[model samples]
Target: MHNSKNSYIHTSAKIYGSTTIGENCTVMENVILGYPQQDILLQVTSQGKQIEDFEFHGCDIGSGSFIRAGTTIFSNVRTGSRFRTGHNAMIREKTVFGDDVLVGTNVIIDGNVSIGNNVSIQGNVYIPTHVTIEDNVFIGPCAVLANDKYPVRGEYHPIGPVIRKGASIGANSTLVPGIEIGEGAMVAAGALVTKDVPAWKLALGCPAKITDLPERLQSLNKI
Candidate 1:
């Protein structure tokens, strides 16, 4: 199959069957789109899961998107228009990314994730499965978001963290699964987020604790 004039796929990139790229998109060299899943880790987990929800096939990319070099986007992923990813990124299957999203380089995004519009995830971030990131959010570089709380034989289905709209996560912070980050909240750099952060608050320290919003942001949106 041939790509339209509105779209450009580099010669070195490999696009598998059942995937569709929209108009005005540029996929750079060595960028792999719509590759099948291995799911080796899920196989080792409890076997009798309802397989339909986790189907892995291919993907659909929206118009005016830009995929950088060496990015591997797994099958069954879908993204809206104006989506951009940095080089050497890993976006797994069963993920949905909204419009105008920016994913930085060396980011690892697992399956079953949902990212809202106008979100920016910086470089070297790790996001596990079952996570929901709301709109207008900013995740700093090197932030690690986990999913599995108790890894005892994977007895239960894992649920990742929920980042509310307009939230900001600082660099090198670690987020435990199943917690909620309130809207407009800000987490400090290198903090370990264990609990829920209230709306418009600031969180800091190893086990993140809420503080008054910074003077700069507080005046903008007082709560």
Candidate 2:
């Protein structure tokens, strides 16, 4: 394989067959690509079957995407252009990320997820499977996105959450599943989001409240 200037693939890095990396991309040290896994499990799986091993389909790094040092991207993850990440970020399989996305350090993103463009995901965040994040959204550090509203032993069906467009979730927050956060809404730090958040409102506290709207959206009151 050929190497380009301004693009660094560390000697310690291991890349497997048929991988495509765009121009001006930096693949740092100790990065591993194309781990093995069971087919179509990342997409969806039925019960009574155990996930045996970790597998990778392939990874596509878009142009100008800077993959920081020690970051690991498991197989079948598709990422768009101008993507950047902090050190030691771990992204699991079957995930799709759009252009100009910024992911902070020590972030953990699992499979069956989709993230839109211009999103900012802070450090130490845990994003579980089957979640969808729309465009221009902000997810703060240590935010926990929960998929199960109620857990029962006999019935073990997991459903992931969704963070809508232009929504800003403050640091250390928790979003319960089966709820939609409306466009341009804001959730304050440390709040537990248990319900659907209305558009252009600010929610805070243990169960979250509509304190006020930000100035940008406040203009609607004038009309």
Candidate 3:
């Protein structure tokens, strides 16, 4: 564990491997940083071996981070400065977060995801692998972003949703795999988006229909 100056890590927090906690960070109790990935852990357990013997790629959390209690961050994850997470959030391996990112309580970020600056993901959101969220994106509560169209059936090439800059994914919305939400687009609450939403447009209802965004809502997000 390589902690920078002025960082406050609770004694109960478990930091492993070559993890680096940046300056002025606060890691709360019960937080687990640099936990081995699933595949690595499985392999070690199958052979009745200890995971501590392996040298996994540890995580790097940037300056001014606030990692709340019960959060488990897998190895190989990196986050920019001012990153914050609510209680019980889980960030998997190979996920990258940009500056000023906020992940709410119970949020599950599957590995291989890329999130840009100023992104806010609300509580109970599920972000699958291969997802890309651009700058200033807001993912509301209970939102589900899929990556696999056919799960355990045929040829599996997971391509998650791509949320462009300034896009807002509404609460309880479900985005199907591989769809691109264009820049400045707004998806209405409870909408089930099955295709691409054009830039600055509004998508509404189940199997959402695209429509023009209101004049008052046309402005880019200031997140």
Compose the digit string of candidate 2's lDDT tens values, residues 1-223: 2334567787887764335677888888887654433554443244433333322246777889888888887668778988888998888888899999988899998778899999999999998888999988889999988776676645655567677788888999988876777778888999998888888888899988776776865322110
Model 3 lDDT tens row, 69-131: 999999999999999999999999999999999999999999999999999999999999999
Q: Predict model 2's lDDT versus the native.
A: 0.77
Which ten-residue region of model 3 has the weakest summed lDDT?
Answer: 49-58
> Which should have the higher lDDT, number 1 or number 2?
1
- Writing each residue's lDDT as its tens digit, candidate 1 over 1-223 gives 2355679888998876467888899999999887767662264245654333333456788889999999998878999999999999999989999899999999999889999988999999999999999988999999999888887766767889999988999999999989998888898999999999988899999988889887677422211
* Candidate 3 residue runs with Cα over 4 Å from true position: 46-49
Q: Cα deviation of 136 in candidate 3 (Å)? A: 0.3
Among these predictions, the greatest TM-score belongs to 3
Which runs in model 2 stand beyond 4 Å of their true positions? 1-6, 38-56, 151-154, 216-223
User: At residue 74, what lDDT does model 1 achieve?
Assistant: 83
Model 3 clashes, total count: 0
What are the lDDT figures for the candidates, one per model? 0.86, 0.77, 0.95
